[model samples]
Target: MVRQDIPLPDGPVRTCIGCRRRAAKRELLRVTVGPDRDGRQTVVPDPASSAPGRGAHLHPTRECYDLAVRRKAFTRALRLTGGPSSAPVGDYLDSRHDDDRPHLATD
Candidate 1:
């Protein structure tokens, strides 16, 4: 008898609102919109990608983040009440830009 090795099936893919590319879900970060304790709009990271409210996916690149902010992609994707406005999500992304740690290449 001979044993054979087979690669496992690739997981589901998600479209990045920033780069407009289809990539594996794991390679993208999920952002969700919710209300704070005072009911004010708030955006948060959805690490598990299973948040209940509206969600959008973004690549980790700074360029992608800028594109999304410029085009208001997040607001549209999440059907936000208002158009693109720098809020919690934007602030979070901005912080990531200053991160000195190197990112692992997905390709």
Candidate 2:
């Protein structure tokens, strides 16, 4: 195999599936579909963005999550055959919302 030493972009940017806003990669949370303990495919959060397969980015907030769900972004973004539940994402966001710290997305 051959490799080329090409210059890379200065910084990375990703768009939020919820807000549809482009922001720095670090500012968004990467989520990808994965199997739950039951072996069923489910939407899971990838805060570290290390998960395999296609992934979608979104701000970690309720409003964004809601918008994403309403618009069925997860289904299209992840390209799933059947609609996947947002429970995992909701639970993840809810857990973060319970925190007493500032968040990237407000409302």
Candidate 3:
């Protein structure tokens, strides 16, 4: 009793730690808490999505990123203590030109 109406699924689904919205893995960016050169745990962007350890997903826009920071979502999602720095993720998003706004379609 298989229904053929189910549309083809996208890739893996992940929730934006910021906006808390579910989107395909390809549509979101992955970040993880990793040790920096100083040996301190910091939230870093995994653009290639190949980093080890647990990872958190987020939209690559300042809005979502800011929302996550406002709500302390990173600490909870990454089980971080002492407020690990998230500047890396912020910088990565800044370097990218695609804000990924919900609407305002360009194409």
Candidate 4:
């Protein structure tokens, strides 16, 4: 019988679209692009991280959000031809409170 030399990491790791840091999947928030009523693409938050589509992970902090926008990471991460507005994400983040941010502490 053959044995593997190295073992895989215990949990899944994903890169943050804003801070560009790799972290456990469960420690990040997932966002997906979906179509609105007008057929225009809109950024949607996947709090449960179970949305059925391509998703980008991000840290749930305003700092990360600003950095992501300034760096235009969303366009590349979300695979959009044009840079999508961050309003949807900003609004969503605004609705959240400090008490809701249990996994957002940075090292």
Candidate 5:
């Protein structure tokens, strides 16, 4: 018996609001916009890429996040009435940055 190479199904590609480039869904982060009980705008991270609301995709980088925030891409993409919280996004990226950093020994 011989094994032959088989092509897998191609996943959907979404454009990043920050970089404005098309990339695989797995290669980007999904953010969803929802309304609170008081009708306040809320941005939620949808890592699974499946949420029951308007979504905006973005690259998982501080630079990209900053660019998106500055351009208000998330609002435009999600047709939101308000902007997303940059602090939470920045903090999330900052934590990831910290995890990638080398720890110093303090004996």
Candidate 6:
């Protein structure tokens, strides 16, 4: 049998729009297309996955976010008109991994 035909883990899985890697739904962040100040569509982080509409998944790391923006994956995945603003997602990733991140205590 080919590798492609094999079934993946039995659970909810989503492809990361940024890195394009499939992972468990809980491990990736959910983003929804929302409007910016001028009413233009933009990608917004949906941590709770409560936004109503087509949502795209992404890795929380900044690297993945950059890949998505650079590759225009967000626009293609979300079917956004024009180039959607990525500032919201960028800001969220930045804030989520600030200096306040807890360091592991080594024995």
> Number of the top candidate by TM-score?
6
Off by over 4 Å in 4: 1-9, 98-107
For 82-107, candidate 5 gives per-residue lDDT tens digits of 56554555676788789999999999
By TM-score, rank the candidates, best first: 6, 2, 3, 4, 5, 1
lDDT by residue (tens digit), candidate 2, 22-99:
778888889999888888889999999998899999998889999999999999999998888779989999888778
Task: Flag the better candidate by TM-score, 1 or 5.
Answer: 5
CA lDDT, every model vs. true structure:
0.75, 0.88, 0.87, 0.81, 0.76, 0.89
Comparing 1 and 6 on lDDT, the stronger one: 6
Report the C-alpha lDDT of model 3 over 5-64, residue by residue, as the tens digit. 654347887889999877788888999988889999999999899999888999988899
Which candidate would rank higher by TM-score, 2 or 4?
2
Instruction: Report the C-alpha lDDT of model 4 over 12-96, residue by residue, as the tens digit.
Output: 9888999987778888889888776677887778889988978898998889888988998877888888766667887788778
lDDT of 5: 0.76
Q: How close is every model to the real structure, measured as TM-score?
A: 0.69, 0.81, 0.79, 0.76, 0.74, 0.83
Error of 1 at 5 (Å): 25
* Candidate 1 steric clashes: 0
Estimate the Cα RMSD of every predicted model relative to the unseen true structure: 9.2, 8.0, 6.6, 7.5, 6.9, 4.0
Which tens-of-lDDT digit does each residue in 1-107 have in candidate 6?
53786566668988998888888899999999988899888899999999999989999999999999899998888887788898999999989898569978899
Error of 5 at 94 (Å): 1.6
- Pairs of residues clashing in candidate 1: none
Q: How far off is residue 52 in model 2, in Å?
A: 1.1
Number of clashes recorded per candidate: 0, 0, 0, 0, 0, 0
Q: TM-score of model 3 relative to the true fold? A: 0.79
Candidate 5 residues lying further than 4 Å off, grouped into runs, are 1-10, 34-39
Candidate 2: residue pairs that collide: none
Cα RMSD (Å) between model 5 and the true structure? 6.9
Candidate with maximal lDDT? 6
lDDT of 2: 0.88
